[model samples]
Target: MSKIDPKDIQKRMDRISEIFSDIVSHAETVSKTRCPYRNRHDHCTAEFRCRNQQAAETEEAPLVCGHEGEFDYRSAWESNPLLHARATKKLDEIGKAAAKRRADARRKKTD
Candidate 1:
């Protein structure tokens, strides 16, 4: 079994962190409303719930998840100029690995 390199993992982790920080900062600046996912009588149907429950309940507009309430980071990320390119590049690295793994599984089944 081939192990993913620690350095590679660390790089990806750093990139992800940068993206997360950018998103949080952007939300804080642009968002005047509370998080929509907090303290609802209705189910928190959104993919990601707001960590700020009090803000969600009281604020008219909540800082919603990037993926239209889905837990994805791409939506907010794409808009950010500071970290978008690097984040997507890191994501591509992961995608390539996943593709390789899938191909390997197919090869094993055939053999």
Candidate 2:
């Protein structure tokens, strides 16, 4: 394999960090509201509890899923049709931005 350039690696890492930051920011917003899946009993009825509960409690931004176990926030979000659309839309935007940055980097490297 060809040796990876340190500068290129750093740029990629920075872009990844930015992407993660954007995800966390969006998660923070989503966490502020009660999860659509939350039942009358205040328990998550789906595969897992709403991640917002955990995100509210912690200083560190929690991923879509607050639990480390079998379920993840993305799954929980996707369980509800409304949430699934919103989450996927936002994530897709972020993913596209990241992909564009990667493509730009590759083009610059080839030039």
Candidate 3:
């Protein structure tokens, strides 16, 4: 039997390594974008990158920070008390505007 060429073998091995690296990189990118916490615009509204996703771990996996499960965006925002306050204030304003519109419609119906 003829012997294999060392150069050909090395080239094949290098190609295999490159293909595997590309596959891994692609998987990582896909995984990071698959979480439901990601918004419709594909942005992490919590304003921080997910460490679990970067590590290729499931969202429910235990993290060194003692946090578990998917990144809770609501909790993240709530952690900043000012964010909740601002959201509540905005909701109040919207409710008032809606009530005013309903009252205006009733007055028009009576007239």
Report backbone clashes per prediction: 1, 2, 0
Quote each prediction's TM-score: 0.29, 0.34, 0.33
* Model 2 regions lying over 4 Å from their true place: 36-111
Model 2 poorest 10 in a row by lDDT = 61-70
Query: What is the lDDT for 22 in model 1?
Result: 99
Q: Which is superior by TM-score, 2 or 3?
A: 2
Between prediction 1 and prediction 2, which has the larger lDDT? 2
Candidate 1 on 7-26: residue-level lDDT in tens?
A: 99999999999999999998
Clashing pairs in 2: 64-73, 65-73
lDDT of 2 at 104: 100
RMSD of each: 21.7, 21.9, 13.9
Best model per TM-score: 2
Q: Write the per-residue lDDT of candidate 3 for residues 8-83, one digit (tens) a residue.
A: 9999999999999999998777555354445444434343334432321566533323224345434433245456
Best by lDDT: 2
- The lDDT, on a scale of 0 to 1, for candidate 3 is 0.60
The per-residue C-alpha lDDT of model 3 at residue 66 equals 23
List the lowest-lDDT window of 10 residues for candidate 3.
Answer: 61-70
